[model samples]
Target: MKQLKDITVIGVALFAMFFGAGNLIFPPQLGVMSGASWMEAIMGFFTTDVSLSILAIVAVAKSGGSFYSFSSKVSPRFSIVMGIILMLILGPLLALPRTGAVSFEMGIIPLFPSIPQYVFTLVYFGMALLFVINPKGIIDKVAVYLTPLLLLALVSIIVKNMLMPDADFPLTKISNVYAYAFLEGYQTVDALGAVIFSGIILMGLKEKGYTDTSSQVKMMIKSGLVAFSIIGFVYGGLIYLGASGASSIPAGMSRTESFMALVERVFGQYGVWMVAVTVIFACFTTTVGLTTAVAEYFSELTNNKLTYRFNVITITLLSYLLANLGVEQIVLFSGPILGIVYPAILVLVILNLFDKYIHFKGIYSGVVGGTLCFSILMFICESFDSLLVVKDWLLSFPMTTFEMGWLIPAITGGLIASIIYKIKATRTI
Candidate 1:
């Protein structure tokens, strides 16, 4: 019974970590494009956004037993390196920028088309820095007002859109709709977020230290299951709400614009302004958590001279610069990076799981080597996307984009890693 109640707090905290305000725009727009197949789209999305996410979180808790502990399998140095890189990627480079851009796109742009975009960007980021440097209960107090207001606004949009699905078909089309939908869902990077977010869950578990490994494992699973349940509910509800957009939204609208249109259509002019404020606040909260966590990890590496406050100032300044680049740019940069990072992260987590429980392999070194190799491939692919009109010529050379180049490389990397582990373990045995 105590465990059940304890699970709720941890579950809710995990929910908040991934529920950053940037998440607001991701699903609704996805659903809008999903057309009649919104349900399929949602299923695909939940795989990355929901399923992998829960697994990552539980995997962390169950494995190395903590974030650093899990990460250490790759070597403390490698772990820290990855942590810093992830923070920067999730911080000023990608996530922070998206928050403000998304808010402006969804909340303010349509309402004031004439205003200079930079003006909004500057103001929004300025407010974000102020809040992040100083997190407090007062903000929580405001959130009490903020969450309900946000939920009501979102609900209003969903209900209205459902009442009026789009008559026109989706402008964007893709085959293997489910697979694409699932991959598209991966764009949000929330699955990666689950690993970053296990801290809160770990803290709760610390309070109930078990005398034995068996008990600890049991507790971790229970807590993880609870967290996954809550997350599943939210993801399922939001994705369904997103896909239900087919009949109502106009064909020409961009994702953010479509969301705002729904807001306006449901609540009239006032709702647009209201949503703007809500989005800015929501974005602020998420960035605070991201920046703060990065700083905390860095401080651990450097032995406290780097302080959370200093990290915030630095990250916020850089994030301000990056955020100005616009959402499309951020998305373009983030995609390939995640491809590399996600695979590396997954391999490491899986290794941690096997080593801790079964005591079977050299999980750490294999992860380190595999990540370095895979990240290079990801970078090469991303470069192709940036430089060439396309990679048709490169595809002929070897494992390329189409014809399953990526698949073969990923499988080979995993196999090589297993062999390396076996060699090391054999020597020890």
Candidate 2:
């Protein structure tokens, strides 16, 4: 009974970290765009949001180390390189900064018409820095306070909307709602967050002296299931809220903005502020976790010459500087970064799990190179309309309409690399 109780609180902390402003904003956008495929879209969203999140706990158990534990399978050098990339990708550059911006847009903006952007940015990041470095009452802080209330308010809105859905539903201009939904889920980066947070949970367990591998595995598994329930409830409610809201919000608003509008309408004045506070707190916690992890990674790599604290301060400042760039700008920048980073990370994850006969050689780099090469080509095609303007030779690849010309090159690269290693028997040498 006590063990089960421990699991509940652990799960709550996991969920709270998972439910940031992006979590709130992403789904409604999906609901709006998912159109007839809302069900499939949300289901797919669940993969990145809920399912992949749970997978993190599972991965931690299997690898028996932090997020980078799986990286050693490829080689320590590759692991460190990949881990650093994942952290920055998940941290201030994208997910962490978005948390503050999203909170301002959804929670604060409606309340005050013209709050200068800098004041909001400074205060928001300040609070995040304070709380992250000095966390209080781990589970209760998030589970009891932020996530549950957010869930309740969201559920009520969605339920009311379902009882009376918008009279007319509008479809997005983009073709293939399911694919769009998948991409929408990709944007949330919840799966990546889960991977990072699992490391946190592992550290938490290790601190409490749950050192036995078998025992730690069991604890992680149970804790992951608990996190799933929280994820499921929140995600489902947000989708419903977005669906209910589609009628009132003008089609002109971007998906992210529309979701914020939906929340404001549903909750009214006080409710909106509550949403803001919740987002700020939730996002803050996640930022701290991400910053700390990255700092620690760099610290270890440099033989602890630079302290973790220094790395945290550096990243937070750099992120704050970038915050002035605003939300849309950040996303625009992330486009190339995400394109390049995501496929490599995905390939690594796949290799980590299913590579019984496979081990990481320097050759894994070949597959990574292949994945990025293709992803980059796809990005160039998406970036420009005319081939004439595409000056760089790297951008001159033949892009197929299948939109997945990258996958072929990545696989081909991985296979060739693997075969070369097998033929040379590099491990023997």
Candidate 3:
């Protein structure tokens, strides 16, 4: 019974941590664009946002609760590379800054139209820095109290909206709703966060006297399921609200504007205040939590060559600068970056999850390499529109039509490596 209680507590905290500002902001627009196919869109969104996140946690726990442990199967150097990339995505460059941006966009600007964007961002991160500097009990307190409040508020909005859906739904503009939704979920970057966050959960388990590897892994999986189930349901509800309300959404409104418009339509003026408060609280906690995680990870990874305080200060300042870039630009900058990193992280997580069954180290290295190269090539082709020849060549690959050109090469690389490993093993025997 006590064990169950602990798991519930941790699970809720994990949910709070993963369900950041992006999670709140992205789905409404996704639903609006997905239109009639919103249900299929939600499934694709769930695959990237929820399933990948949980699996990343499981993979880390199974590998003894560290990014290094799981990624080292590929190579020690590869592990370090993965750690650096994950930290950057979760830290100053993207996720951490996004907290302030989201809060400013959803919370502050709507309420205080005259306030300078940078002023709110500065105040937001300053407060977050204070919490992150100490970083011990702040997250726990927020999780225990703030997270539940946020969940309750979101559920209320969802329930109210669902009970009284808009009379006419809009037609979807997206032809490939499932693929578009899947890519949109990448904007959340929770899968990347999951790989880094597993350590935090595992350490908590160890401190709680659940030191056994199997016990930790089992508990982590359970906790992950608990967390992501809530996240997935919330995402679905938000998407439904967006889809139902799409008919009323003006064509020129930005994603955040669309969401705010949705809220106003559903629950009137009071609903806006309710959502603003919830989003600010949620974004603040998420910022503090992610900043602390990145500081701790990088500090330890550097063998204390850089102090935790230094890392915290550096990341906080960098995030503050980027936060002033405004929510839209920050979100735009994230796509190409995530596009390059996400596939590699997914390949690593999937490979690590099945490490025992697939005993060949070469398979790990080969698949990761293939995935990385192909994903980078695809990203470059997309980024440089002048690369028409490259784009044409890439488009000819299997699954390329789905923007999944990496699949065939990754599988082929793994199979070839596995065969080579088996041959070497047989000869040695």
Top-TM-score candidate index? 3
Write one digit per residue (lDDT tens) for candidate 2, span 306-380: 776677677777777777777788878765777676666666656555556467465556777788777766577
Residue lDDT tens for model 3, 204-285: 6776779888899998888888888888889999999889888889888887788888888888988679779768877876
User: What Cα-based lDDT does every candidate model obtain?
Assistant: 0.62, 0.66, 0.82
After superposition on all C-alphas, the RMSD of every candidate to the true structure, in Å, is: 4.7, 4.0, 2.4
Q: 72-155, model 1: which lDDT tens digit per residue?
A: 765777777787777677777787787777766666775788767678878877776666565333223223433455445455
**Which ranges in model 2 have alpha carbons more than 4 Å from their true place?**
35-37, 47-49, 134-149, 159-176, 268-271, 274-278, 357-363, 377-405, 425-429
Please name the candidate that would achieve the greatest lDDT relative to the true structure.
Answer: 3
Query: Where does candidate 1 have its weakest 10-residue lDDT segment?
Result: 135-144
RMSD of 1: 4.7
* lDDT agreement of model 2 with the native: 0.66
For all candidates, what are the clash counts?
Answer: 11, 0, 0
Query: Which residue pairs overlap in candidate 3's backbone?
Result: none
Give the range where candidate 3 is weakest over 10 consecutive residues by summed lDDT. 134-143
